[model samples]
Target: MKISQISVFLENKNGRLAEVTRILAENNISLKAASIADTSDFGILRIICDQTEKARQLMHDHLFTTRVNDVIAVRLDDRPGSLAAIMTLFEQNRVNVEYLYTTHIGQEQRSAVVFKVEDVERGLSILRQNGMETVKGF
Candidate 1:
């Protein structure tokens, strides 16, 4: 229903992002998807990787502040009004998105959009009842 996304709390300074990537690279963890939200002082690095638990432990061992959050990943047609259709469902169900980020996969014909909703279970159930497909796996 949902996937574990690695959220890293990092200072908003030069080389900080690179350091995190280096750590993951050294451990051979492949990043499948990622997003970042930042402020003046800090940033949250939301990442989806093949080895989530291992990535979490590695970050912890390296003294980096991180957490694992359940985020919903969905597949959507890569065309106009695709997203609008999904949001319409949430609006109908009164589900607050809170925050969301997306990435594209495949070519222009088909693609996927991953989102982080406020409530995982409720969101999943709503999506299911509405016949929305959820992306799975690490």
Candidate 2:
């Protein structure tokens, strides 16, 4: 139901994103999914990595502004109506999605949507009742 997400604060200037990626690459942290939310002068890089704690520690050691948060990652069918169905479930339950990203897995067309929901447990239960699976990384 709950997963960890790393939010790295970066300036809106050039090379800022490159710096973050370089650091992660140097540390061998695999980014499974990522999204950037920008404001006027800065942006929050929300990232799901293979090794979250280590990535956080590495960022801290490098003096990168960052925060760790709990989120939800749901696997959905890749067909056209799949997303609609999932969103309908959440809509019916009034689950607010703060952010979301998706990626394909293996050979299957089905995709996994990583999201930050308003209510973790309730969202999980709603998804459970609808037969949706949550991906939890160790």
Give the Cα-based TM-score of candidate 1 against the true structure: 0.92
lDDT of 2 at 17: 91
RMSD of 2: 1.8
RMSD of each: 2.0, 1.8
Residue 6 Cα positional deviation in candidate 2, in Å, after optimal superposition: 0.3
TM-scores, each model vs. reference: 0.92, 0.90
Report the C-alpha lDDT of model 2 over 84-113, residue by residue, as the tens digit.
888888998899988787755444545688
What clash count does candidate 2 reach? Answer: 0
Model 2 CA lDDT for position 13: 98
- Candidate 2 residue pairs in clash (backbone atoms < 3 Å): none
**Candidate 2 lDDT score relative to the true structure:** 0.84
